[model samples]
Target: MNDLVCLLFQSHVKMITPMLLKLFIFASVYQECHGEERVDQPDPHIAEFEGRSVTLQCKYKTTSPQPELFWYIQKENHFPKYMLKRNKYGGEDNDAQFQERFDSNVSSDSVPLTIKNLHVSDSAVYYCVLQPTVTGNTRTLH
Candidate 1:
């Protein structure tokens, strides 16, 4: 009985060892592919007159073929609010509150937020965000 139990345990270990190794390799490759993503807001401060238009620039570096870029606005003492998101494949969505005045286009490496008829309320910090694509299966078995 002791020898039988030992043999079963060794076989189970051998079976699981390859699966663990494969998972480690997959994780490393996933990190290597998705690790170097970043977004840049070139101008920390921008000034514009009321009732005019201003464009805020955001640049990004990503390995995703269909990168999704987003814009957010944050008021004083308030959390960031999602304004819009633009995809490389022409997909986009804008918040109802920003539909009229906020617009953007996704280019090869940058997305610029253009606010028309700027209001005093629009005087807040704007942020550019990047959403990286998921390349592999992300589900876990129970």
Candidate 2:
């Protein structure tokens, strides 16, 4: 009777061991797939025009909370310069430059830039920016 009981216990352990290992492996693969997605994920879209409004979409992912949104401009071979600060919901703060040439707003997830009177000189690169709080990372448009 003791021999039969021992045999049954051993078989149960053998059956459970593989299932536990498979569960662990499945969890690891799931984590790996999701992890790769979070690294430097790209935004949905960006648009530009010579004499019309432009909208730049920004997206980000982090381990912690979401951060502020911003707009910036950059010159050739120069560091980025701040243009406007954005509310979390995408409203522009109306900086002097932004108020002069552009009307802007946010709709919870996007920054749409409207150039009231587009000009040839307004053809420089513009960006919609996002800062993710937990990662302390910044994303920009070109």
| Top-TM-score structure, candidate number | 1
* Model 1 per-residue lDDT tens digits across residues 56-128: 8888888888788998776656555799999999999999999999999999899999988777778777778
* Cα error, candidate 2, residue 16 (Å): 56
Q: What residue pairs clash in candidate 2, if any at all?
A: 90-106
Model 1 lDDT, residue 65, Cα: 86
What's each prediction's TM-score?
0.72, 0.47
Candidate 2 residue 92 C-alpha distance from true site, Å:
3.9
Kindly report which residue stretches of model 1 are placed more than 4 angstroms away from their true locations once superposed: 1-35, 139-142
Compute the lDDT for candidate 2: 0.47
Q: List model 2 lDDT by residue over 54-81, tens digit each.
A: 4444443434344556665544444445
Computed on alpha carbons, the lDDT of every model, listed in order, comes to: 0.73, 0.47
